[model samples]
Target: MNAKTPDTPIVIIGAGPAGMAAALALHTVGHTPILLERYREARPAGNILNLWPPPIKALQEMGVDTDDLGAPCHTTFRGVKGNIRADVQIPDDVVKAYGGGFIGLLRPELYRRMLAAMPEGVLRPDVEVTAIEDLGPTVRVSLRDGSSIDAAAVVGADGIDSMVRRLLWGPSERREHKLHIIGGYTFADVPGVERNEVVLRHDRTVQGTYSSIRDNGRDGIQWWVLEAWNPKAEPPADLKSHALSLARRFPGPLAALVDSTDQKHFQRWPIRDRKPLKRWSKGRITLAGDAAHATSPYAAYGAGMSIGDGYTLAQELTGVDLTDAAAVVAALGRYDDRRIAHTTAQVQQAYVLGKVFHHAPAPLRPVRDFILDKTPMLQKQVGEKSPAEIVAQLDEMGAGLVRA
Candidate 1:
């Protein structure tokens, strides 16, 4: 076998979906990569994540079975506000193009499943990375424990606030948004909301999502509220009150979900984003997933994009002359080139949706709701304006890996 770095393993930063998926893909290509995570272990957090179809094929290639991950189906989206409520039907063609539907699994369970797929001793927890230096032939990664190691290549899958991204592009190069989200899950399910549907509640200034998440043999309600505010503003000391304030605009079920949430389970996340970079690699160090391009949850493709990155990147590197430093750099470059456009579109779509959905003026709300109710445009907006093009990219990635 042709080893890219004969003496050193390719070091993968972060053990999240993207990093672990990268490890899985690299292993498929006969390369062993060590995963470093800042956390001690995968703990349960966040609500259900909709893993769309684009990345499901890549996940299957990496030995992940989407069937057992969660309920793989489309949850009907019911728009609610005041006395007005309407069901938003996604176009059948769009759903069919996406390869059936999505898996609305709990985020932590997905994390655990991906973690368990890795071979033993591949992941190191509680190892915080401090710095990374591109030393031409090898990349040097420094840890918080006053230790460092050299690798033939370094993959930055550390996520949105990626230290690797900061190291590579510096802090000034990154871009973020003002949309702040505070969310939590309740141990009890909300009445009136069906098991296979998600209710979207919105007012003039805020929106919330309510759905059911199954864990530990019982179903619980998982919900989130999005509101735009100053990034520098301090989060409210009374989280419950803050959450209610956002949910006040929403009607019964959403408010009830928030009220049922325990204080311990409440979490606030400042939704941040980064535009696609012209270049995601320099020498042997490069980035994948959120580390390279973090999108708003409006796109709902962040996890899928990151998971697909590992699959596609590994596919591009397979059969290449890894021993040749120049060839390795070129392979990394090709990975970036193939991903930039698609992920950029994802970022842009999410950004625009975030702006329009949460902050649209009162007068424009009618138009927005009318379009969502009467046309298939909303389906395209949530699913990509060019569904065929996105499907083609996903197909190419899957086909390329099969060839690998």
Candidate 2:
């Protein structure tokens, strides 16, 4: 926690939710800020999203409530083998107990909200940042139009392909080479597709889930998918055709969701993740959001993590004078130390969950589910898990992450 100091204009790169959230948090702590975006009119692919519990808590602390944004999220269906008709509601009351409840939103709507909350000059849409130079005490952010400004600190919320991370941390070692993700916002709405349920395909080999957003008359519905694949074989550019191809492989209505798509709507990416860095900052230049930690889309925590980072960074920079060189660098180093472990653990946990869910054969799947289905106590005794109070008992000590 930083003590409140004179306002410093922190430069935030990228206008995605992570960058926007960071900008907002910095503003909350009394800082002048500037946010840059590469696209003048960047619109999300209209992907629907359900905020999980931990992030729900994070957002509540940040001041954007899910209940205020849109509809409540309830689990209509989710499971590896069979569609368990469980009331997996992170129930409104349960969510409220934890300080926040879930709310669904269209990407554009969410984008609009974060932008609207900014204090006028903070967000500069259409301004693309081309280069960033670390000047020890100050970082210079150069935009595409050949303009530059010196700032006390610069944040790279530019995403996994973060230019800042590349310049500073270098490309992290590739954690996995081949991950198949078939995603698209679609128009054809399927019957009984609950607006909140995270629908999982029982054809476990083809792991997929769709969060239901309200149907617009044009694009009736939307959903996305992630599965194991060979990157050298099938990359994401061919996402549409490949998704349609994968659609033909499934037996249930899940395939119908895919059949409704044209190539334009199909989006595919060979999901790649970089191993986490021990340091997320270098002097005055700091990486936040996806720049620091990039997780596969399977977890849907990427945006939320950025929000957390933005808030944490704002908290760290509260008292430092931007003009001071040593303070800026030291603050950044401390920021990295605090965040690297937390974010890396999140990324690694997603990987382990991916392995446990996709690769586990049927027999093991039952035993895995049985333990989970029984009670949280059984789960904790067996492993150090924390999905629910009862679920916390699933995993053993240090089972989720590597902490330095």
lDDT of each: 0.73, 0.62
State the lDDT of candidate 1 residue by residue for 278-325, as single tens digits.
888888988988888888877667888898899988887787655568
Cα distance off (Å), candidate 1, residue 379: 4.2
> For candidate 1, what is the lDDT?
0.73
What's the TM-score of each model vs. the native? 0.85, 0.76
Report the lDDT of model 1 for residue 101: 50
Worst 10 residues of 2 by lDDT: 395-404
| Model 1 poorest ten-residue lDDT run | 81-90
Model 1 segments beyond 4 Å from truth? Answer: 1-7, 42-48, 73-100, 144-147, 216-218, 361-379, 383-393, 400-404
lDDT of 2 at 130: 77
Instruction: For residue 246, give model 1's deviation from the true position in Å.
Output: 3.2
Candidate 2, position 204, lDDT: 47
